[model samples]
Target: MRVRPFAVALMTAALTPATLMSCKPSSPPADGAQPPAADAGPSSTQTDTAFAALSKRFLDEGLALNPVSATQIGEHRHDSEIDDLSEAGRNKAIAWNKAMLAELGKLDIQALSRENQVDALIMRNNLEGSLWDSETMQSWAWDPQVYSGLAGGAIYNLMAREFAPMPERLKSATARMEKLPALLAQARENLDPARVPKTHAETVAKQNKGVLSLIDTFITPNAGQLTGEDRKRMDAAIETTRKAVEEHQQWLDGTLVPNAKGEFRIGAERYDQKLKFSLNSSLSRAEIKQRAEAELKRVREEMYKVAQTVLKDKPGAPELPDAPTPDQQQKAIEAALELAYADKPGREEVVDFAKHTLDVATKFTHEKDLVTVPDDPVKIILMPEFQRGVSVAYCDSPGPLDKGLDTYYAISPIPEDWTDTQVYSFLREYNKRLIHVLTIHEAMPGHYLEGVHSSKFPSTLRAVLRSGVFAEGWAVYTERMMADAGYMDNDPLFRLMQLKFYARAVANAILDQGLHVDNWTKEQAMDLMVKQTFQQEREAEGKWVRAQLSSGQLATYFVGAQEHFDTRKAWEAKLGDKFDLKQYHDKVLSYGAPPVRFVRQLMLQEPIQ
Candidate 1:
């Protein structure tokens, strides 16, 4: 599955901060904080300096406001703190966002450097989006996942990485654990069951206990590392948090799940607004639908051609026609895909296979000289229990602030209760060839590679608020790029799998809007994924649950890829004979994963908006 790097970060209304600092800037001056008397109109250098200063100030204050996120970002000063989820706490965050945005607006973006202009836009969108989420969308009152992610991340972030010593991280985890009860209480108090979606309530109920597992896996083992009073506090904190989680789980089942009467769909009006902020793209819902539908038709045609090549002489191969009907096309493609699915991994071998594929993909990228491959280590691991029931896989890159840490390419393990038939369905979907494509998307020259490059960019603000559009889009874009460059010696089965994978991204764009805005039925969604996109039964069902659980996110893969393709085409056009694929890839990534349009503008030297 494609990675959702900003999944929780975007959904939750917090703007995560940079590393530690005590001093913070004062409130924004009136008139949007105009320049000093000595300078009526600030020079280019002055505007740049002012914006940099403001950006630093926001990061400092933001870390204090949201310490869980701070810990996740490798900011250790706030490691012992957690964001207050109460009404007053949210208002305080909202007010701070407003103040930072006001100070941001005072700067002359035109006069500032192109890079800083992108930072300003990112900061503005995050601030505005946070306010809208709190004031208008009000997800806090309805979305239990928002709070659950926060609770789980508070413990997970501190222990998942070793940015600090184990003993130090354990102390921080204990502090956060001591705060878990109040966070859970605030979640129970703030969430109105009548407004919570049933799917969300059920999922969070399942996930709430997963925190206990995180405590056990990451915390319990290391408790012995601490001595004397520290060990005592750790033991006591763990017991306290375990009780709190158990009680919270009871409420989730007995109260929230029973009373969850809310609609999962946000409706068209809200989806349109959220898409603008979520994507940060000029493309409208109509435009995305138009392009995705067109790509759907085009990719299916390409897949049918591949089917003809693969099934050319097989005894029971479906008839392949030059101008096939829709039914004929579906059969031909399915016949070809089945051949690829025949080489399936044992359920127990999925993680080992994924690790092997990562090595293969990394080797291929290095051999191809595709882009500058980072030496940053990526580890393939099982998806944590708390974060399951969403996507099957993800790329968990370390926080940009946390240098030299390993990036995780986490694949969800096969569920124990799944029938043999269900497991077969899953293994077939994530077959040997497709697993290579998946590894390329989630690891090599994908999210992991892009993240390494993004962190190296000079601006802290840009790294803090890196663009999901660019990150996801670049990952999706690399799938096709790798296939074109003859990954696996241009194996047609691998190419077929790559197209099928790309088709899912195309299908996601259509699926996202259809489910959230157009009121698509389960049957309609199934037809799109299964019949049209050729997804396995297991994959389609999981996506149905994920679609309801998320909004506007499903569109990112398609939209981001489209923008990336456009950026590359523009670069090629501008550079003409001088264009180099490796150079283009390196240059684009160096921009810290801004919106594709901004990357294009920065590359082509166009006017920054």
Candidate 2:
């Protein structure tokens, strides 16, 4: 989410005595005579005042409608309310967006400061995206993840943090839980079984079941703290919510799964629209695919060279190939990747390994002056069960309003029931060096670092309307940046692992488009992952499921990294020797997580697109 200029202005007004002084009377007005009726005519300050007022109203009203988002961002005002999942609710959101857009159109962008112009654009894009999602995309009609996420996040958000007293939060959780059954009922009423995709149904089923973990692990333990009446009510609500989740799971398995014959693909037309909204970039889908394809090849070739370095002395290692065939490249790359895979941490040590890696990455980041490391604390924790099966690792940053709070670097442990092969595949894919890369991407200079900087941007809208591309792109970019800086003494294994991640980024774009747009089969997708990117079978299979389960998101990594790379190159060209990597990074992130295109315009003083 982008920051709102009004919040920034308010913070400035509150903190800067000079700003307050400037607003006061320059001299006493005739010992009690009115301070000379304030200058009411149009002025630069008036423009800011007008925009700030509009920005705040827009944000405040917007948050009211999207209470789930409000809660996620650490705003407690609507913690007890569940999002309206009814048809009327959808219409209301659409109407609200329309009204906001109309109001935004009235703002004089040219009259506003550069920062406000950026804020206005971010707000406009967000509103437009929302309208598009509701009207054209109609995800509510087909996507079960929407409801499941709300269901799970409703309780998870309240329980995961100490944003409020535990009892207060528990009270809110009970309120939300009491409403859970109806929300699930609304999901059944709202979702079109004929339109629901099988992958979505399966994923949501898993998530719905996982919600019980929240009750068991967090809510149940804390319920004891409540007095008798409150405790009884809370217990009853939990029991009811658990039953609702179980019933939903049963429906998912019995009814939804059987009827989920719909295609997961949004097709090219919707994909293009949604992709534009998701990326907020000037590059077209074709352009992104072109860049990704090139990068894929380049990264693969680089991986081959690194493989050659790692395996040069090993007997029977595949001969160094000068322009090897795809099969030969895969063979060689896998051979070298084994060196990293051989050093895997025990299953129990994943979190500890990530913790140690965070320390090392931070130390190297500061020692090399990569970017200013914030003193903001970060902790490594197991990903909650409900959030599992979506992605293996994530950086769960505190809401922008929840500054200085601990950011969770969540690593999903291997499922206990997995077969030996599955376990091996998981470990090999996340090999020790790659875990370092993961730590760099999810913590240190990745999401956690960027999030900390974004929280201080002073604009609520900017923090709320954060660009996924910028966030994911910066994280992906850091993997390469760290590798380029010779972290781990420039070990070929680490560099190989870094390049593999780059390949995965490229593969992500390819897999997303290929599956959702090109209708690539699981075999074809797996071939690309295993053969081209050297992903293990289990990793490739999980990615296949993920690709089916999502769209456009996978492309963000490659597209965003390219934008970051291009922006850096342009800045370097413009500034010549004056360009500094650390300064550039700090400056880029200083604007919060606006789209890279906006960042480029701001950095270069170009017109906002």
Candidate 3:
């Protein structure tokens, strides 16, 4: 149920299924089955060390092929690069993942200490299963996150960072152009037409439009500067892709658009496999459904109390208010955003605000002796073009391998040339819960500072298996954590309103997965957001679309937060006066973002590396 607006970048425009993903050609794993190997020689601890080194190699391959991921993690080697779309590059990555898996599978997990063994097994299964999913699941074929994120990263990296020189940027763009035709062709060939989710196809169409705009706005003029044959080559390449992109759009509108036949659910079989590999356990579908429903109810009661606290001023706020009219809904959403962000400064003012937020929170945390603050400072960057066309904001952590890199609390600006209607639509949608809860999620003792410590973890495998649950959980947990820390010490209303948004995200995880995988209706989903969670219309609508494209994600917020909170409570009971906040936080983040279960084990005096 963990759903968040931001993770990867997204594209805007219709696309022919032909123009599939632009990077990581390594196709998903072959058949969801792993080829068995004899257990490695020696004990569990030795095996864990071998597997950790193996996973590091896998991460290196990921960075080499997908440079944008590297840049996000603070790797500058490929800062101005776009990945090769040729079959050769894709095949190489695929081969690399496979080989890494083979080498890793040879290790014996039974020999390692419990904590190291847990991480080892998670890393091993993660790599092998991911390799399987890469080829078999065909996630990039229609998953909007895959498509949008790939394209979005391209745009954002080009626009957002000045990490590389202009020449390097232009060269990468030029090189990218040369690979476009082949890239599109391979995409079509590798992506099975039958597998795309109807939701994915539709989302991609809209996402593609935004991506196409980049060519006219950024690439054409930028690339036009190259001399001689290079200029001719780049321009011709651009023109060719431009025409192809139009055809791609036409294909989406005319063919895939009309013929898209996809189901949001992966069915019980694939879902189980995903639970095993992606989540690092054998959690059954029934188990997740049960867990989701239980959490849903618990979060709802919390939301109701929060709503009463914040919206008591609104006459008969109707518990949850999804306006029947779109306009009314949009207005409600707008009002919600305004309420949540009452204390924060605008995007341009956020860096200072980031520091100030930490200082303010640290003051209380120090006084109350809550969790300790991370030592490294973080900065807020304006959202890059690559990450545009999606959420309002996200906290981007530095890469595991990179040193002295800044953590980015990226805030996306409104599109500069948009019409007033569009601008207002965006603001209206981003209303209260969206902004306030996100601030707590992305800043303060949330992602930015947390990341600085996570990046320094000793376990390389632990770093790679950064749990989406823990990452999102910690962020969501912080929304409440701040309130408890007296975030709006002066204005309790702000704290209450923020809780409503946090609840909305909590509901999102349940409703998102329920709708996609369990046949929950839109009315049901909307009701949860409006009445139970208090989402504004525009934000709620966005959530609907986001939920369709995403499943098994929204739950990370509540689940991770709950686990984090529980762990802290346990530590306090165990250590009493010895449970220093600084030591506690440092300990929690020390194992990187492993699944909460693994983190729990690590916290119980278990060996992580």
Top candidate by TM-score: 1
TM-score of candidate 3 relative to the true fold: 0.76
Candidate 3 C-alpha lDDT tens digits along 175-269: 55555544455555544456667777877777666656776666765764667887777677777767766666776677666777777766556
Write the residue-wise lDDT of candidate 1 on 174-270 in tens digits.
9999999999999999999889999999999988988899988999988889999999998999999999999998999999999999999999999
User: Could you report the Cα RMSD, in angstroms, for every candidate shown?
Assistant: 5.1, 7.5, 7.8
- Candidate 2 per-residue lDDT, tens place, 304-362, comes to 89888889989989978787887788789888888899988887777678778988999
**Candidate 2: lDDT of 444?**
77
The whole-model lDDT of each prediction reads 0.80, 0.75, 0.56
Candidate 3: residue 583 lDDT (0-100): 78
Q: Which ranges in model 2 have alpha carbons more than 4 Å from their true place?
A: 1-44, 380-393, 411-420
Query: Native-vs-model 1 lDDT?
Result: 0.80
Best by lDDT: 1
Off by over 4 Å in 3: 1-53, 60-99, 110-119, 140-159, 192-194, 215-233, 281-288, 303-369, 374-376, 384-392, 412-436, 606-609
